[model samples]
Target: MAELSGRFRELQDVTSSPTSGVPLSLTQREPEPHANNPPLYDGDPNSCRAFLSQCLLVFALQPRRYATERLKVAYVITLLTGKGREWGSAVWDAGASFCTDFEEFRAEMTKLFDRSVKGDEAASKLARLRQGGRSVTEYAILFKTLAASCDWNEGALRAMFREGLNFDIQDESRLRLRLRRLAPHSSWRLEETLPSKSHPPPQSPLAEPEPMQLGRIRLSAQEKQQRLVQGLCLYCGGSGHFALSCPLKAKAH
Candidate 1:
């Protein structure tokens, strides 16, 4: 009887061991079917299609959640869709769109475009215009005119204009000429009357003799004393006698 018990215990251990008996691999089981009803999407073609369509709709309506480096793509997408108007309104209501850096602008742009265009042609055009020497206002005008000619919606053009105004081209000469035209009368005259040459003519140091020492003359006691003591004429600080006895003075006399 003891030998039989030992054999039975060995058989029990073998059945419990994973590698021994029928090995039970752990697997996630499918949820059991409800007894009373079925799932809303279970094996129904129409429901499955509807569910997928709704998911796509949500993605389409939602703003893209990733960062993008392409500014033109954002601009074009906003222009094509009505999202640009929404963005402009929000920014206007907030009272400003000029942020601290390009990153903030880009973030705002991405938020404005609900979806991203992988290789948008409109974006390429914007990039080219930016690189070309067109002012933002000029580009916006051209864009609006061209879009209108091509039968694009008017509302989109207006939104694009609002967004484009933030980018201005630097024209130094145009700015200077504009400022000159707008200046006050006095400022204008001052600018206009300024001498062409900054420096005056070079002067000759010894071209003519001074008036007080031009001719020989006798000096008074006071003048001679002043000249001897100070080495300068009493009338002029010249290296001679007083102005009263100067040759120029004698000529006048």
Candidate 2:
């Protein structure tokens, strides 16, 4: 019992020693300090308020430019959200920027949707409104909303219809009918013309002098005999006698 206690004490002492077993130096190496400063993660309401205020200021100071840019930015954000790093980077490289306010951005997005839902039927409605001298911007805004709210293809057809309807009424009807026919196969927008399926016909070569072969054939013996033949010639397969004695009836007869 005495010897066993001594062995146990020796084992405990070895484990507790700084210089023994598993090399204390290996475990005691000092940790390297971080290169960056500690992150300042302020969970306070004040910090959030300040950040939001700055964004609002930026938005308000340049609403028009920001509005235009924000439209594109919002589209990018929606595309990138929930995607992996590779997809996010792809979108970023593809010219997508971040928008500070999604709500304002969405309001603009609604305009596009509204236009699409109207499909190709909005042209006459828009024309009537236009002839009545309604505010063009208001009319445009209504169209925009319609465009933003619907499927991309549908919106495009609606826009094309509106554009076609803007021309002369008679021409507009033909254009509208064409658009209606085209709507199923394509999503053509009002802001642009539809692409043609085939190129224009090539121009013909310049005129040339008649060929010698054709000219000679025109004055050949056969040709002269054909000219001499009268009505119902037999040799030339008509009902007259021979080409030499073909008769001519008097005009009075």
In the range 97-131, model 1's lDDT, one tens digit per residue, is 44223345545544443242223333333222221
Worst 10-residue lDDT window, candidate 2 = 244-253
- How does candidate 2 score on lDDT? 0.35
In model 2, the Cα lDDT at residue 251 comes to 15
The residue pairs found clashing in candidate 1 are: 215-247
lDDT of 1 at 93: 39
- In model 2, the runs with Cα more than 4 Å from the true position are 1-132, 135-138, 152-156, 159-189, 193-253
The TM-score obtained by model 1 is 0.15
Tens-digit lDDT track of model 2 for 1-253: 2333354345445534455355546434543332322222232322333333344454465343234443333323323222222342453445433333455543433332222324334333332233134333344456444444333344333323243223222444454454445333444433333222242212223342222133343334333223322222212333533222223211111
Tell how far residue 74 is off in model 2, in angstroms.
Answer: 24
**TM of each candidate vs. truth:** 0.15, 0.18
The lDDT for every candidate, in the order shown, is 0.35, 0.35
